[model samples]
Target chain A: MTAGYVDEMHEAFQTDLVYRSEDVPLECSPKPKDLEQTLHGLMKLNGLVIRSLEEIAGRGANAVTYRAGKKFGHEVAQYFQKRDDVEGALHELSDLLRGQYSFEVWKPEDKDSYIIEENGETFIYLVFHDCIVRQTLRRNGLDQGGPLCQTLFGYVVGAIEEITGRKAKLEIVHTGPNACLKKLVLK
Target chain B: MEIHVDKDACVGCGLCVKDCPMHVYELQNNVSVAVRPNNCMGCLSCHEICPAQALEHRGIYAAKRHYIDIHVCEMLKKVI
Candidate 1:
């Protein structure tokens, strides 16, 4: 991107512009099937691009994508008001990171607690049950926890850091077809 | 959260036993059983890799799989 474009995007995060959403007129509304088709096609294209980058950029693809995701996620976090506590941030973020990217603060059924405290730090597990990134990877026959997955880690860390004003880190605990588990540490 | 293992359909490949990150399943007497069902996080990696499709997860969150094409799902329904 050009310097001017980057500057404009950065400036957008500082704006207080309130916008209103209006329903699209019936004539302008796309058909449900057509929209699904478009979504599927775009995701497939996204998969292709990720795979191509994996092949071309090799290991560096992850760092680049992670940084990009962090920058974007930090910007997106501006939409939400900051919080005082990690638990409050988690409660609020679980809602914000929903719908298209449905996430749940998860724990084992046998475990009485989901969050653990140690060494003045808090740890929690976040499960990605309906992630677009997972869908895209699976759509293109790619493995989980690849470079694309790093973007999610970066995004979560960025968002949590911004919301709580704390340094947060995320680690992949497990990944599967349906859901992936990640551990977030706040200090 | 009940995990059902169909012994009739199980080929005893032990893929589920190997693939589950939580080590939830174990092969006993040539059948897969949820030996550590309490540990299962419901990721369903075992359900996906089963060659015989013998495992079933009930009362678990079925993650949205909108990535599957509508047309392809229909075609699979016809073929299966």
Candidate 2:
């Protein structure tokens, strides 16, 4: 299953490369093993990032982010299934990444400072660096950050599921700011 | 030859931006605008999946236009 998935992803990537304005990186390949590691690592890191976001966003913001992330995750699965090559998967995932979500950070309007809220809550802050990344990804619909993140998390989990042949559930919402999970559920 | 990304058709998916090993593509207003077209390595990636087919690689490979239909390419792949 992993090999199959990698084959498909590689092809998808190649197909996707055709849409590029330039030659694709010669580095892109059909390395299922590398892709597998990449997906798993990314999923883990995203889980961590969301936890950090919850801590920063406070007040059960986890639920909202989790929900959004989960939706995006489903899309990634669909993306992989749809494309026969890496390019197709990437393009499809790119489309998914275009989906909209909201994230906020501390601002002068709310308060120039951060505040911890109830539920072990704290200030709802949007990091400037994050915002920059988000804006850049969405700037020209090129990066698809939110959707990509959600889909990537989902893609990795789905890939794992395919590999293990065991159903895994991930519900990420309300896990607290620092809570991490193997699954995500919106609200 | 030079390649130009039709801004009107560009969805700015950034696939081109990231795919361009040459670092020739960039995102502008959620659309892909080729800033360094002269540096184009003449890869047809952008032209193939513009969704709107918004990219045209002129100059060198211009004559190769219509060399392969995408659907045909996919079909041929299955046969080969």
Candidate 3:
């Protein structure tokens, strides 16, 4: 009975659109088959984000700090320093999540999406986005020329799964004036 | 066998520590200190991942050179 509900929910939710940007497609579909491969992809995407910022810093640009609001009150600051491997970043993120962001929730919305407080102020939304990654880069400064189309959200979802060790209740929403994929919360 | 860290250019991201097949690094405060310098097989992985270009490995064959920027080196050492 539970399995039927899950499958039904998955089918219903996966077809919705999250956000639309330029030419990027919506991540409103089923996830990859293997979890490990998806996790590796997420790590690589994380690496890409870091590498992009590093490239900016390499050109003599000072590190820029971004605040993801209080939900992510912590600051992501870059610097010129020794390189550590992928494990280093993963470990750091693990520590940070364990120590700081274990509890955060989204602002309440009356829509179908349910908002639940996990621990503290941390909010999780399993939102689907058509192209927030490319949009974010464009906003940061990259032209990406054409509508940047890539599917990177699955990897992020996989990463979150690995971190939390819980199955995500996925959802897809349509395009919006802004690029936001899904809203996830601890289930 | 000399180990040098370009303190100023060091972004201190700690990728080297993770990549170190020899576990030669640890974070002291926010900086990476080579706890086991000898374990560095002189691999350049650390140098490549270093966003700030702060680390370099000089094996027996390689000569001393500026892996990271000198300006950064000057700034970080004092802060450390």
Candidate 4:
């Protein structure tokens, strides 16, 4: 009945009733064209989930979304080998996230390296240009830096931690219509 | 990036000055002005938060709107 219900009910529910499937099933192989999904529809659906999470859990929705995203990131990172440096880890991270969270390393005009050390602590700035979370928020007329945004923060931290074998924290520096900036602090 | 503050449309609300993380805007003569355009990361927070829609940035990276539907894009192409 819900977004992931098909996977839960795969044994019982057939192809027609299924809206989406995470894994490929031999019974019904619905092509992209047959899914009947548009960008607006998917974004609005995401908006619905976000709104629902907010209404039910209030500010706590951020924690839920963050945990979910972290789990997703950890899962994705399991496929890749451990990275030695932040740059390599981030490259693999970008490739893994791809269209979902398209981003680039950002630095000051004078700065050359993506990694920056502040008072002996090290971190990197990430400029997320194409984010589905932003699109979903805009579609729902919601503000930025909310629970939906935390999901991304958690995702980046989780992926970085899994890849580099080091704890990481993500902090939002700025949010905008076109892009968002976040600081990834490696612990 | 070049930030232009339309003097005519500016309401002197100080929203842009308050919202900019880079502190690129400052209120001079009760109107928002780009005091430090170089510091601006081109995030466009001021553009969305401005009640008057008075700020514009030139020669900046415009992120892709992959969320837009192809059908709507085609329709908009006809209208514009």
Q: Output the lDDT of residue B67, model 1.
A: 86
Let me know the TM-score candidate 2 reaches against the reference structure. Answer: 0.24
Model 1 residue A126 lDDT score: 80
For A34-79, candidate 3 gives per-residue lDDT tens digits of 3434444544564466456557665322213221121121223121
Candidate 4: pairs in clash: none
How far out, in Å, is residue A104 in model 3? 52
Off by over 4 Å in 4: A1-37, A109-113, B66-80
Superposed Cα RMSD, model 1: 9.6
Candidate 2, residue B34: Cα displacement in angstroms equals 0.9
What would the per-residue lDDT of candidate 4 be over residues B22-70, giving only the tens digit for each residue?
7899999989999889877878989888999998899988876655566
Supply candidate 3's per-residue lDDT for A17. 58
Candidate 3 residue runs with Cα over 4 Å from true position: A1-187, B62-80
TM-score of each: 0.82, 0.24, 0.24, 0.77
Q: Which regions of candidate 2 deviate over 4 angstroms?
A: A1-187, B62-80
Q: Summing lDDT over every window of 10 consecutive residues in candidate 1 chain A, give the lowest-scoring window.
A: A23-32
Candidate 4 per-residue lDDT, tens place, A3-36, comes to 6777778857555664566866676446755554
Q: What is the lDDT of residue B55 in candidate 1?
A: 91
Clashes of 2: 38
Chain A TM-score per model, please list them: 0.79, 0.25, 0.27, 0.78
TM-score ranking, best first: 1, 4, 2, 3
